[model samples]
Target: MDCILHTERLTKEFKGFVAVDKVDLRVRRGDIHALIGPNGAGKTTCFNLLTKFLTPTSGRIVFNGHEITHDTPARIAERGVIRSFQISAVFPHMTVLENVRVALQKKLATSFHFWKPERSLDGLNARAIELLREVDLAPYAHLTTVELSYGRKRALEIATTLAMEPELMLLDEPTQGMGSEDVDRIRQLIKRVSAGRTILMVEHNMSVVSSIADTITVLARGATLAEGPYAEVSKNPSVIEAYMGSASVELVGAH
Candidate 1:
């Protein structure tokens, strides 16, 4: 399979410390690749580098056969790589429909026209509603963003990112801070949304990651501990020691 995103010896350094240390990663076209790690494992740093939020200290980043290591975030985004934050990132003062409309306007490159109402943009309202429905937020389309529950806000974030029409999505802990029911809902939404694109996410929830990840890469102390299917990773001694060892066994069991 062709890799839509590939990094060769990708490294990031902060002063004297190495955050991401010479890692090689490949995300195949249309595959949902999960990056799993403990806190401070440099997963977010990797995403930032890939998105060109931070320039890599060393190594190369290629997207669709183009060397994009030095590209700007907007340039990278223009090439169809978009990231959704771990924190809910929508306009709290805006209505649900308006929030999605903002995303649509940006995607349509109509954000410069301050005088034009969203309805005036070509296909804007219809496209916004379609994205809302895709994320299961159409029912609350007219409600204020602040009125929606935390879980729904996350869903809205996904919908907004989808409105960008990206070919590859980088999701940072998409289900963070949600209850079991909400987690399940977002998990299903992720699977639904990723049908035609590549998805790379940093997730700590084992059951959720195991259930949906087409391929899992385990990170430990800023390096890959294991990379393979969940079943293959589950039995790896290094992965077990990093996450399910005796010290962490109780915590894993509690979940």
Candidate 2:
């Protein structure tokens, strides 16, 4: 399979501590790759590095055959790599349709033009509504974001991310803080969105990872402890030891 994202010896250091040690990561095109680890295992740090939120202390990050280790976050995003659904990314006061339309504005490079007539930007509404439908948020189009439930809020964010037409999306814990039903909904949403695109997610929920992730990478102590499908990685002694007592509990229902 062709790799959409690749990292070699990716490292991040804070003073004397290495938050993310030399790590090699590869995410295949159109694959849902999950990065899993225990607390303080540097999963998020590695995510930051991949998304260019943090410069690597040492390493190379290549996306779609271009080296982006030193690229700015905006530059990386312009290359079709986008991070989604940040809580702050949505404006609670704006209507759901307005929120998505704002995101479309970013792609149109008209986000800064407040003087433009509303009709001038009407072209974006159709595309924004299309994205809303894609994420199942079309019904809530005219509702204020604050009126939506937390789960729907996340879905709205996904719609916003889609407006960018990303080829690679970095999602950190898409199902975090959700109930079982919400988890399932988001899982299906993620699957729905992964078409023709690659997703790299840092998630802790084993069940979610098992069901949706095409590939899983386990990290321990800021290093890659294991990498493969969930079934293989789950049985690895090193991974079991890292999760210890909770491994079986967490992975019991995982296939």
Give the RMSD in angstroms, all C-alphas superposed, for model 2: 1.9
Q: In terms of TM-score, how similar is model 2 to the real structure?
A: 0.95
Clash number for each model: 0, 0
Q: Which ten residues in a row have the lowest lDDT in candidate 1?
A: 246-255
lDDT of 2 by residue, 16-89 (tens): 89998889999999899999988889988888888888889999999999999989999999999998633436
lDDT of 1 by residue, 104-164 (tens): 8888788898897645864677888999999999999999999999989999998888888
Local distance difference test, per candidate? 0.87, 0.87
TM-scores of the candidates are 0.94, 0.95
lDDT of 2: 0.87
